[model samples]
Target chain A: MLSYLPIQLIPILPIKMNYRQAKTGKLLIDILPNKCDFCGCCVGVCPEDAIELKEAEIYIIDPRCTNCAKCIWSCPIEVIKFNKEGVLEK
Target chain B: MKEEYDIIVVGAGPAGSIAARYAAQNGAFVLVLEKDRDVGYPVRCGEAISREGLEAFIKPDKRWINAEITKFGFVAPNGKKVVINLGKVEGYMLERRIFDYELAKTASVAGAEILTRAYVNDLIKENGKVAGVKFEFRGEQKQIKCKIVIGADGVESRVGRWAGLETHIDFRDMESCFQVTASNVKCDQDALFFYFGKEVAPEGYFWVFPKGKGTANIGLGVSGGVGKKRSALSYLNNNLENFFPTANILTQVAGGVPSVVALEKMAAPGIMLVGDAARQVNPLSGGGISSGMIGASIAGRLAAQSIKNNDLNYINNYHKEWKKLRGKKHDFLDKIKDGLFNFTDEQFNNLIESMLKLPEKKRTVGRFFMIALKNKPSLLKEIAKVFVV
Candidate 1:
């Protein structure tokens, strides 16, 4: 004599974390202006779609980016600007 | 125990062994000391040599070669490919471990005594001249006296520094490199691939020297400035793994190569530095094996001749002969290496595009120089002047 009951379940809440905090301090995202020739190499090799070429220039979508650094290696121009502060001191 | 020899070679690498072989064959007592527990262990080289260069010392022995390459593929920054066919005078990918050990055997056969696990700490100087070396052998310190000391030690050689020579290298003149012997990559066994691009390698190039079917030494050398912030190893790990996902890594090595102008001097008062210690590597290709051996051969013969005649003045002939043989070529190549390192990404892309347009048969090493000097004909004019002079 068992009665059917509605399944009691708990929903896991999505954690809100900053992009810079996710990859510790090592994560760097760079956006190169006019230097990127839309080679599609970055787009093809990026594990995360943080890098996108629009109108023949590479732009890092900061909010959607995870800062994995896959884009930096894929860019043949090597012109990507690092998102981290104090990384590009001359 | 007190031991004495006519000539003492400080390393057991190619240069040292060749020097020892020549000296021993010339009826001079020679001793070759090696610091490594095993000769040719922890190999650090691109392992490729031209046939013309190899034939100068010893004939090609197939046992030590991994592959014989007859073609070359040069890829530009824009992914354009240029293929060059070399019918004869082929290059080789060597198995250095076997090759170096075999070289030591050749020296031994010529009556040279080789001692392993002997680390030379300081050179013995008598009356302000190099006499021999004091070294640690089997955890015990020992000193051996000899007439002439040959410092064939590799890069970072303290022997040269200890002897009061200026051997310090600038970071701008160093190429940081990373390489791994990978298997299961789809590369042509008969061709060597060279990739050039700021994106690929900031200051240098990526190479694929095949060993056999489905295997090759895949590597890259980047400029030191780019490498200083990150690393050459990090750049390779990021780029190469994606292209050759299935390629299994058998061996990995990271090192620096000199891209500077050749040393103005090579010998001083009973001391001669050969191989990387002397900065004999080709600044552009970073190939030192052939040049180093050639330098060692000349040095050994001259050193022995000088000892026999008791004429130290004849040593200057060795320096003159070495410069006559290859110094100009090295100077020209150094200029090219420096020019390539300073190219911006856009300029690099333009140069590559221009090079790709060249006819296949005309794609010589000389042509690359011409293309690099397109806007500035002064370099080409200077090269021509050198040729004429």
Candidate 2:
């Protein structure tokens, strides 16, 4: 038998990292107000017109979002983020 | 207590400011609310505008001009260059920050009450008509009532949407645009350069607009679907660095360009959408500064008239006039952009290749366009329609 570390230790061995890489599909759009500067770049960069800026606050429309993170790169502060299973990506 | 006004315009961009000025000039108690502390700070535009478009509304003022463009040029995928002198057409690279502020100043002088850092959060809908707005100012929520609300709130306008108008743009008609101001770049100080290639822009184009003697605004726009995998910044940067490796980026900007026909409905019982909110930008050029100002002037005059007549429905006349003024022309450009959007890199190359074979004098802008339509002869009929109707 190949020498194996204790199975109980597996849970504590950064196993969450594997779960993150396992996420191959599903797109998530997250706009954190703290990271946003109200530059309105995302409003202009969005291809689907999914992003809205009202009273300086930005919000994403669910049906129109399309998970296309072009808006993410549009942010100067890089506050807009796209994720696959909580893994932060542009 | 909610303040009352004859007309209230949301978002004091060019459209809002100009609308406010016009409304006040027409004897309306006009009020303008701006979410941004600075009127035109953090500009998210390429800032290039045509002279003809500018003259159609504003009397040319040097205070807002950054560059007086004399020539405009294009580079094809095959590395061919075509530059044209500004014959009858005039163009300028605007200093939008100063330009917008000056416009706002005029509005204020015309007796429009302008409040900056005032964010309009929600609409006070009354019996299916927009009657007033609740906004946040200095961290306090405030409300104001008005007879007419001009939605000059830009491409991502909520005022229009809140008034129950369809404000969505199709992905194909939207251009995800990114731009950067670079210092010490090699640029034609008086000419604008546009680069075309699938690998360069992918259903869009890259542009270099000179701001001054040595500084330039370089950017590109890519259509929505193809941009899903990459960023507009990446495409713009990669191409820019390839040309001017030593250029230092001074500022960066990203935004969307609405390149489509006007929305089906731009006015309701008491609300009217102007500028990009109404999809008034040129589909082929991704420009709306002049068009928005034109739309705002019409809206301002109409809003004042509606209030004076005690007929809130006067907003409809504004909508109708806007269609006749710019909407019809934009609709024609929409068809042209739709056709150009499908052109492959090879076709772009062919277009340049064919144009280069023409005699020097025959290679006019008008002639170049004619040859591009040679293969797609059917498009000529539509082109004629653009003029006939």
Candidate 3:
């Protein structure tokens, strides 16, 4: 006689960044390469032209970027890094 | 196939028109666009502003004002009232529909091309930089090249988002508001009334801004969290009508106000966001007209200077200058908003009771704020803590 058993389902988790780091506009910068995804997500989402992609690479052209965190939030690859020296880790 | 401008201002609201006016006054080719068939056709504000804030920009023409206010009334939950004399604090109730349209006309007189029923759909980019905008005018889509784009789109701004700026505002930081121009209300036309009670409007307050004898803009702004079960209009309809039983509703409007912390940033390369689009509204009062117009003036002047100098970095300077000018006041008001919204009904009642105990001559809103701060030092302490965090 076979006994029926209940199966447990584990949920898939998203790659989570440190909330404290994100709040302070600090993140690991080494992850991003020179080229942007060219998806135009950051371009469309920016209230300011702080982020611009040229030749498949994204650059924070303006130092006055308010760091509203919209670009980081919208980036599909999570490659945009926020650092004092400007993407130092990447 | 038309003329090109140095600066293109989208939306003909207070911010857009003011930006156009300033840019044009500086000899920049300015074009102002209005999507609506007419400027300020459907009014959506309580229309109350400090005379001082207005005077700082320009002497407000008499045609815009509906009535001048010289006193204020603060009503508690149990019907207790406190009256504050105007002293040197002067105010006005305006007809915004006329006021906004007139402001746009002023911009046109300054040599800015004002176009109504024009809808801007997308930004025209050259070499990955914003060079102009593609828009629909009278059902024909056209491209107009510009050196700078000033987004003065009011609360529901799409221009900023399209330019790649994060313009997201949390629901909790918003105030869902509703207003009606009612007649036969039993209130002094020269005095503005503010009612505070959880039952009346949880996490928000009801306002009666009188236009003239027996007529006023009666409105309520409820905190978004408190509006889960019912809308702000329903809450106002439930409580305000009973207060002025004889009042008859004339016009109705529903809108949202940002009561959150101001946006950390307001500008980016080749783009500047002003007015409600940049969340420049006062956190405590949710007022933006004066602030927006002032911001536009500064932005327009700076944008023109930047373009003349071939400085693409002008957007950053505009943000820095605006913050240096108005950031402190905004931060202080934001602290007050956070404390006031977090207060429970019991705490609010206690605050009212404490204010009621004060002498009539000393019961001003400014004084009330001082007393509340003194009594509940934790409120200020929390503000300090935010900086540390």
Candidate 4:
């Protein structure tokens, strides 16, 4: 029964974003909103130290993320999405 | 309201819980601090424990068992499968969250106080000896002074760091892993599978351990370091269709394992490390639950003995006794693991091809390892010196 609940309903986040869109047109790694439980494994494996957790919010500083995909690959919950441009808009 | 206690153990996983339980059971005032609000909130393991060692501590209970497996197979990059059949393999895939929670509860019932949401930030040191820990308990700062501090805080432990121990590992020795519990897998409910090859899991390996009928935990460990290419999740994602095309994800998790040992130094004057924090995993298989609990048992009993006797030197026994217990075996495993990681994909295929030549009935776990090492006589001799001695 616990698995059946939508990830958003799991309460991994109290302040949930609907979606993080890639505004830069460059390849971006985005955390699919509401699904990330903020486990911080990505922050641990990021080669560039681009990913950071500030005030319980997960963000990949635009300058450091090389689109190496480690952050997306390292995400345990699998909520990280990779994009060239606004992929979540679809 | 004395803040000082006899023993303080951090992290309520198996090692910490067992240490606390034994310390309290021996009449020492014990306290356990867990950062997570829940005892086993995010399961980071493949959850398999060999009955060979686990039974020595606690009897098997139905509540925490997911599946009991008796057979396993290793598949090489070339699809050569070597099936190992034993009269009994004695491995269990656990529901770790519940298992850890129950273990902590057992410690509490044994007289150790348990606290959740307590994030230990630093050590309370007096004259460069660890006397206690400073922690943030649910939004408030709290510090407790104790005679002994046990660090069972997983792989990235700072407690060991604060004790001035070099808890660092070569990135190559670290296995970055991603696993998922899922249903509709085509694996045998009573058997486990290991897949090897550079394309499959790089230097580590991929595994599928079934929980029950049509469900299992499928995952892989990718080689970790600065120049690491593929991620464990991507490898599993790319290969899941090859093995179980119909697999449906139930739960997914990502983690890293310190596939090494703490033979050099696992303790200081007043502090000790166990479990992943102690780097106590089997280097070859990266399994730790049972071995860690065994270390914890030694640490716990010695912590109690030393305290009860007011002999701080008894704390020294934690290292000696634990080494006497499992140090040699883990060292052997590390050597074997390093050897295996250096094997090329063709070597994996060759190893599998060689193993497959044995009669299916002769492919028991013992023989598989024996024959795998037969190719490397020097390593075999080293294994003999460590394990056989």
**TM-score attained by model 3:** 0.79
Candidate 1's clash total is 1
**Per-residue alpha-carbon lDDT of model 4 for B278-316, expressed as tens digits?**
888888899989888988888888888888999877888
- Superposition error at A60 for model 1 (Å): 42
lDDT of 3 at B14: 85
| Residue B279 lDDT (model 2) | 83
In the range B86-136, model 2's lDDT, one tens digit per residue, is 554378998888888888888999999888888887788888888888898
> Which tens-of-lDDT digit does each residue in A20-82 have in candidate 3?
232225432322544334433344344455554422345554443566655444343345555
DockQ numbers for every candidate? 0.02, 0.20, 0.02, 0.09
Error of 3 at B15 (Å): 1.1
Give the candidates in order of DockQ, highest first: 2, 4, 3, 1
Which residue segments of model 1 deviate by more than 4 Å?
A1-90, B375-378, B381-389
Compose the digit string of candidate 1's lDDT tens values, residues B209-273. 89886889888877646754666666687667656788899998655566665567777777888
For model 1, how does the per-residue alpha-carbon lDDT over A14-85 read when each residue is reduced to its tens digit?
344443433334346655565544433344334343444422345554445566555454343455555655
TM-score for chain B of each model, two decimals: 0.95, 0.95, 0.95, 0.96
Q: Could you tell which candidate, 2 or 3, scores higher by lDDT?
A: 2
lDDT of 3 by residue, B1-389 (tens): 35677899988988898898988887788888777778886777889988977777667777888888889887777787777886754988888998888888888899899888777778877775677888877668888998889988666566766777778666566676778899888788888888887788777889999888689998888765665455676778887656987788899866667676557777766688888777888888888888888789888888888877778776678777777676667887888877777666666667778878887777778886776566567887876765564
For model 4, state the Cα shift of residue B244 in Å. Answer: 1.7
- Give lDDT: candidate 4, residue B196: 87
Candidate 3 lDDT at B115 equals 82
